[model samples]
Target: MCSNGWIRAHATYYGVNDSPASLGGACGYDNPYHAGFGAHTAALSGALFRNGESCGGCYQVRCDYWADPKWCLRGAAVTVTATNFCPSNNNGGWCNLPRHHFDMSMPAFFRIARRGNEGIVPVFYRRVGCKRRGGVRFTMRGQGNFNMVILSNVGGSGAVKAGAVRGSRGKTWRQMTRNWGANWQSSGDLRGQRLSFRVTLLDRKTMTFLNVVPSSWWFGQTFSGRGQFL
Candidate 1:
């Protein structure tokens, strides 16, 4: 668990019939299923969601009890990645209910609960290091000389605190501005050369990925590197 310790929250799932299951949520991820993304994704409430900046953050959740004690998982827990927003004012929404809440994926919710009790379950959860299969992923956006990059597939202190970029032909590294959520923007044009990026995790540790973006990279394309904060 993260330094925040175990927090009480309500846990629910979005089954195949839900929008998040059929179509991706607000985070822009297309495939979030367990077979696709390993059933490790979740939608967090506004209290802990941090807008979209919480994307990639990980949490460890345990089903302590449901309507009946038999439905509990006996403390077995599952780690889920933050990938969408759970709004607060949508009638049944609990995103802003003065406490942290997690609307987990169906597979993730079941991982910590007994069968047939998949509805609302009482949970104890906390922030934790994200264990991911690959290194970090960088998605390119924007056009011309400007660059807007979205960082994902992050592990460990899952959220990025800062980032920098350098062009293959440029002599110095340039810092990127946080546009919103996991997206960052570089001030100058990097269209003519391959780009290298330096990322800093929320834990204050930093890493440099050299030449991760090819010179011929196009807008809306994504590239993966071989390093992570974990």
Candidate 2:
């Protein structure tokens, strides 16, 4: 962290300006808009991605106008959701380890920098609370004894640290392991049962979404909870 809470970093942009091409990413938010992230999203470097644990996290980023006045838009900042990863490149890319960087969507980058900044700019960023429109959502996938759920629309700390699932027929909650990105998996056969979820956020607050998934739920269906992290 920088002295004043902001951390020094570099930023670049990818995909078309505000287009759907920027939607899906490594975080499994195939359609960020549908996942409640909108187009204001970014791909974090390995230093920040934390092996996908940083997915759904929010950050406030602004170009360092004082450091690069010619390319930065003074006082302009944008809050973006972490939805992708900026992999390390053998050619010593900006996203390489030890170098904090943000691969932002085109629209997000342009918000804080001049259009012709050559795709990169000095930046300062800080984690911020995610202001989602609703309670946390769970998108269900997989079949039979294998269950995969993707958590989204998270608020507060935003990123989920851990999760557990309990079916109506089960007396105890079973821990769900991280499958990939924001997807959590469980080998329990939870078919034809109402599902409750207990999610722990990075802040250590656990919110239990009781019976968030109905017994009639099907694959590829998303269920919304009634509670959200503060």
Candidate 3:
């Protein structure tokens, strides 16, 4: 403990899968996972605010909503949630409830050949329009800096938006993040090739963002990669 009486803690955690079933009591326990990597660091420690658990709000008292054009009001000084893990109507209660989108697809034959064959691997980006459902959590790690994650999108003109998703608020602790991204990971049958994208909500001050979903092409192209599209 420091002279100020603030106690510090450190620990390590392992095991690949960190699911809600595993972390039940903790706040924002479901869909617990690491950003890109770091099984131990993610479980070690950081800052934890449960789903719907908030200290008043991320804002002070009087602030403007700059994250969205619809969010207009000089209400409370809260962090205009560009991304939210709390069980909130992120789109403001039905006004906006759409999954993060990324549009990209290849013929089923080509998709299979790409993942299964591996010889002709096609690498591209798909923009993640938004988060899937509320509780679209974020698992962050590291202390010295923010955990980096890239959100690749496939644009019409064939452009890739490269960026990283980070958890900056929780930096002091060794590493900790407890968010539940329930609807973020879902796969089912589609009409044609599932061309989708993954959006990584990043700090513009540090990272970038992208979109996913449109024709739903790459949804089933590869269970290995697409499975973790969340």
Residue 171 CA error for candidate 1 (Å)? Answer: 2.4
Winning model by TM-score: 2
For candidate 2, give the lDDT.
Answer: 0.90
Give the Cα-based TM-score of candidate 2 against the true structure.
0.95
lDDT of 3 by residue, 101-205 (tens): 111111211221222332222111111222122222222222222222122111111111222222232222121122232112222222332222233222212
TM-score of every candidate: 0.87, 0.95, 0.22
In the range 1-230, model 1's lDDT, one tens digit per residue, is 32458877878777756545334465655455421246668888888877677777888888876434787777589999887888876326666767578888777878988778647788888889877677788889888877898788887878888899999988898999887666789988788689899999888889999999888999988898888668
- Model 1 alpha-carbon drift over 4 Å, by segment: 1-4, 21-24, 33-37, 66-68
Error of 1 at 229 (Å): 2.0
Better of 1 and 3 by TM-score: 1
Worst 10 residues of 2 by lDDT: 15-24
Candidate 3 error regions (>4 Å): 1-8, 12-41, 44-179, 182-190, 198-200, 204-230
What ranking of all candidate models by TM-score puts the best one first?
A: 2, 1, 3
What is the TM-score of candidate 3?
0.22
Between candidates 1 and 2, the lDDT winner: 2
For every model shown, the clashing-pair count is 2, 0, 42
Instruction: State how far residue 21 of model 2 sits from its true place (Å).
Output: 7.3
lDDT of each: 0.77, 0.90, 0.21
Best candidate (score: lDDT): 2
